[model samples]
Target: MAVVSLEGLSKRYGNHLAVDDVSFDVGDREVMGLLGPNGSGKTTILRTLTGYLRPTAGIVRVAGFDVVQEGRLARRRIGYVPEDAPLYPQMRVNEFLAFMGRLRGLDGQKLDVSLGLARKRLGLEDVGETIIGRLSRGYRQRVCLAQAVLHEPDLLVLDEPTNGLDPRQIIEFRTLIRSLAEHCAIVVSSHILAEIARLADRVAILLDGRLLAVRQVKASGSIRLRARTDLAPGIVSALRTAMAGVEIAEAPQAGGMVSLHVSTAEDGAVDQVIARLAAAGIGIVEMSEAGADLEETFLAVTSRKAFH
Candidate 1:
């Protein structure tokens, strides 16, 4: 069963349709990435899911509880970390978590256990008694995540979770996200294509308050081919013949090696292209699935005009 479900969900303000008929589900152990430009209704959709705003139309359920009708119950099953997580600068890490736990109706040993587990999972052991204002930006983000998961919610929602973190912090944040996904469903919203590609199992693209496409990100489809010889007419012809809709372009040469950027619209094109090259004896020095980068894919999806 889906831990989080939204069917025909729409939210409007006056004449503007901020979210139009947005619908999707997040199951156990799934990380759903929400992608869109500014004013695309990603934050509005997330707020609706968390029961902070009543949708203008459509149904939303979290852990089988209706967000509109049973908001209190529904909210208990969700963990939300907004772009700017409000933190009390005066409070210590453990003190703040304890306060949040009590608000969630946790007390006594249960609250202690929850706080302990959250600290360990989020690598906050050293900062338990540290003041919130004194922690670094990365540690602050970790605290936000720790508080979100403290209640053991069934679904976790994060908006631009890595916005200001450094490179190393971003990597550590990604690790924490992956670790959190082991027990609950996660919905992350980000404009950074690389972050979504690295952290999410599936990506849902939103454009003008409408869902454009949901893509299954895999490692084997992005093919980068390098040539031992110059990208000659013969090599280009062989590639075009072997793979339809393959995009090939010249790349910077390294160590006197000719390089070509090859992109395929379909999977398994790499194998066929490699075989055809060998038959015609076109030197293929290196060919591998390119590392995870979804910038091109995001542009391809979002560039299309949305239907009225």
Candidate 2:
């Protein structure tokens, strides 16, 4: 079953609808990237998922529990880190984490084990006695993350997690997020397109309070094929017809030659593409495996005139 599910979820404030019938799911151990611009309702959706804001319509479920009817139970399975993490500057790192753990109902031996694990995972062992106010921005963010996972929630929600961090810090944060995903599902809401492309297994794009598209960010056994021939409409159609279930797209290249990117999880997909191209008398100048271009997909979806 999906770790998190949203069906026809909508949220409104007065006459303004912040989210409009947005629906998606985050599977177990999956990292879902939520992408959008300002006023696109990314934060609103996260709030609703975490049981902070009751939905104005439809249902939100986490681990089979309705967010509204079973708010407490659903919330207990989730750990949320908002854009600006709520922290106490006066307290030490260890002290703050312990307090948050207690708030989550951790106690005695369980609390001690949880605290130790959180500190170890977040690299906070050396900073245990350091005052939160004296820590750097990156360290503070780590502390916030540590507190969130103290109880090992089934789902973790992070909003603009790498904001205000340096390049090195951002890289470190990405690694930490990937490690966390090994044990639980994660929902990352961020404006950074590149980060989402790297971290998420799939991406859901939101625009103007509506869902634009949900796209896969990673593909196995994908290949990029470049041909010297000009790109014709028939060529693309023929390729698709030849390789069922394979995703094919024309990628922009600096040279005059046409570039096609093909992706599929099926075995021998490359050999099939080669044979099909040969059969079609299409000359292949170059062919090699390539990763998904999420930016291209994002642009195509958001730039549609109908959406505007």
Candidate 3:
């Protein structure tokens, strides 16, 4: 079962519809990225998923519990870090995390274990006595993340978690997120395309309060072959016949070189393609796995006509 599910979820404020029929799911141990610009309802959808805002229409379920009908149960399975980290400036890191643990109904040995694990995982041991207000932006974000995972919820929700971090900090944050995904599903909402591409297994693009598309950021069993010479039409046809269920399409290229993207469901497709191209006397220049084209897709869907 999906860790988080949204079906025809919509949210409105007065006459303004903030989210329109947005639906998607985050599977167990999966990283689902929500990609869009500011004011595109990414935050609104997240708020609804966390049960902070009731959807104006449709349903949201987290771990088989309805977010509205069973808000407490559903929320217990979710650990959310909003765009802004909610921290008490005066409180120390350890104190704040302990307070959050108590609020989540943890106590005694259970709370102690949870706190110890969270602190160790987020590298907060050295900063345990440091005031939250005195910590750097990156460390503060880590604290927020630590608290969210205190109870080890089934689903983790993060909204613009790296907004103010430096490059090194962002890289470190990405590593931490990936490590967490080994145990639970994660939903990260961000307008930055590169971050989403690097962090998510799949991304759902939102625009103008509607879902534009959901695309896989990691293309499994896909490779790109660049040749100095173009393959003959016959060779292309022969390759298609040789590899059933393989899709070969030309990718945009420059300097008169040919770049073909080959995607297949079967293993060893790369070896097969290489062998055929060599047999056809095509001079292979480069062969690499195809990465995400999320930027292209995002631009295509969000494009608007130029004004005179």
**Predicted structure with the largest lDDT when compared to the true one:** 2
lDDT of 2 by residue, 1-308 (tens): 99999999989999999999989999999999999898999999999999889999999999999999999999999999999989999999999999999999999999999999999998999999999999999999999999999999999999999999997688778889989999899999988887887678999999888899989885346778776547535456666888777777776667677787787665445556666776887677788756547878888989863131
Clashes of each: 0, 0, 0
Better of 1 and 3 by TM-score: 1
* Model 2 alpha-carbon miss at residue 286, Å: 23
lDDT of each: 0.84, 0.87, 0.86
Task: Report the alpha-carbon TM-score of model 2 versus the true structure.
Answer: 0.77
Q: List the candidate numbers ranked by TM-score, top first.
A: 1, 2, 3
* Candidates sorted on lDDT, descending: 2, 3, 1
Which residue ranges in model 3 land beyond 4 Å of their true spot? 219-292, 303-308
Superposed on all Cα atoms, the candidates' RMSDs to the truth, in angstroms, are 9.0, 10.1, 9.4
lDDT, candidate 3, residue 262? 79
If scored against the real structure, what TM-score would every candidate get? 0.78, 0.77, 0.76
**Global local distance difference test of model 1:** 0.84
